[model samples]
Target: MNQQTNSEAKEFGSLLLDVGVYLLSSGASCSRIRITMRRLAIAYNYSPHISIAPKSISLALNDEADNALFSGMRTTPAQGVNFKTISGISRLSWNASENDLSVQQVRDELSRLIALPHYPRLVILLFVSVAGSAFCFTFGGTLLEMIITFGATFCGLFMRQEAIKHKFNPYICVYIGALVASLFAGAFVKAGLNINFEHAFATSVLYLIPGVPLINCFTDLIDGNILNGVVRGINALMFALAIALGLLSAMLIYNLK
Candidate 1:
């Protein structure tokens, strides 16, 4: 429990908090965060305890001899999904544990992972719109319906990305995206451009679905992280509500039955 050792424990605790928060906000399940943090702590010869909530993570680091302790908490970043980052961090944890990496080395790897760029915006927009069109086709939409769906989805997702870039409220962004999507599709429906307009309209906004959050909600509940599960479930419900409201607005505007 010397001063230097105590300070090191505190530093390690802070690092653990960083990792937990990053993982949680990036859409890792609560159980996954707990397991990852535990592995990293044990690798560095510290015992770890963590509390993961919907919006924050708390971690404690204790020396093997139980003579020094450090506790820290960090509010999670804005929620998003990045499977690449999650996989990278998971691999980093395994490497750190196997190679007995120093705390600084782990941090460096973490920094590099965080800095990794996502797919270009245009590529995402193109592929996501194509997926929406594919869903329209799968639902028996006509060729014209698929084309309209592609346009709607492209515009809708673009709006969402812009809203996120400007830091709009997440729910508002969903609503806006859905509104744009449904409105675009609904316009064509009203114009009598396609027989299967409903299919296109329905599928255009599929990109806005909170799939990751909804899946993680059940995973957390199954793993006995009830508090986190409930919070995530509620968040997913809000997104659904936003989408519904947005589509409703479009319906009203277009006077669609």
Candidate 2:
């Protein structure tokens, strides 16, 4: 029975580590990752120590004997936000804490949650176009410019998605998206489709802003996760730079000034 219990505990800790890695890779803040892992460990009668960095997560679990019974670390690539996955994992942690589910049972629930489908690609594209069009209107774009911005943003998002799907670097994808949007807006101006160049150009690339990363950077700092906060902040800055470079490149190429 002791051997069986130890085996179960080890399996539980390993699963918990995987959960932390998944959360980190899926864009959860460092504080959120640590808190969720600790909560899950408490639920399973283990003590957890978790560490999160920009690209990796480490978890160490202790059994009743206070021995380091399990330790795991994983490196994950940067991934786009998926609030559904984050919220599902949060609910799973809370449920596990409340219901006293066995390790295998928790694993099953986690698998089911992870399998939940994401929003369809078409829906995401529609939302992105709508957001860009809304920004254009807010920035004083004429109706023609707003319509053009919408179309440009839609096509730009498609290009960005294709680049990402083809395994291009994220920075390159952002640059490409910005370039596509700016060129489209510039072409419209050159062709006399719209004259309010400022509004069109400004709003055209707004969809590429790294809003989540910037927000998470501040949140991490406020929560005292300095290293992770700095990493996120730098990433946000790099993304902004890539976008600016792309926009400027488009302007020079198209002679938009």
Candidate 3:
């Protein structure tokens, strides 16, 4: 009975961490969220992978830039609390039964959510409009293409918003952003609009900063978890590749005309 209860607690703690991750990524309104998980084990108190341990639910919120993923880790020993020896057979629980805190899980969930076609539909449409404006400018339709690009770029700031929402696959987002920018550039060029590709490209690419995961990877290495670090680095690299592919696809389509 006790073992089952502890197991349930760990699962619950994991869930809380997941939610915390989402809030942090969402850039909603947070400065930061502080969290701690407490558990007691019979033989061993913890594992490195679990975000929180049963005995110490008193940990503070860590930052993305800090690389605290595996860095600055310290083991909380089970014994000597209240003068009693602790065991490896652990029992775990949480303070708040309501808030979610599962960071990594939520990252994956957000990816799945954004991957849906509907989310990109409007974003893509706005991009097309910008492209048309550029096409007009190239062909001497109007000088207003510059104004259109400015407005479109401003609204697209939500790209950063999504990043905060824990869209770990930043490369895909960059690709889409590039596709939008390139569409405009190609259109302007094709239409003989007087516009600089460099400006459009620079304006839209700010959405590609995969900052948090990169920090996590660095932190993992600092914490002596090289394997975890390498894995995260690979994921970052793949995201970068996705961005490149998005750009390549857009360019290829542009050249076809």
Report clashes for each candidate as comma-separated counts: 0, 0, 39
lDDT of each: 0.89, 0.86, 0.42
Better of 1 and 3 by TM-score: 1
Per-residue lDDT of model 2, residues 1-257, tens digit only: 36776677778877887788778777888888888989999877788878887888888888756777778778874567777778988998998899888778878887887778878999988899999999998887778888888988998899999999998989999999999999898888888763788888889899999988899999999999999999999999999998999889989998877
Residue runs of model 3 more than 4 Å from their true location after superposition: 1-174
**Residue 228, candidate 1: C-alpha displacement in angstroms:** 0.5
Q: What residue pairs are clashing in model 1?
A: none
Q: How are the candidates ranked when ordered by TM-score, highest leading?
A: 1, 2, 3
Residue 74 shift from truth in candidate 3, angstroms: 21
* Local accuracy of candidate 3 as per-residue lDDT tens digits, 189-248: 567656555444433433444555567567766776576566667766776676566556
User: Which of the predicted structures, 1 or 3, would earn the higher lDDT when compared with the native?
Assistant: 1
What lDDT score goes with residue 248 in model 2? 96
| lDDT, model 1 | 0.89
The runs of at least 3 residues in candidate 2 whose Cα sits more than 4 Å from the true structure, single-residue gaps closed, are: none
Taking all chains together, each candidate's TM-score versus the true structure is: 0.97, 0.95, 0.42
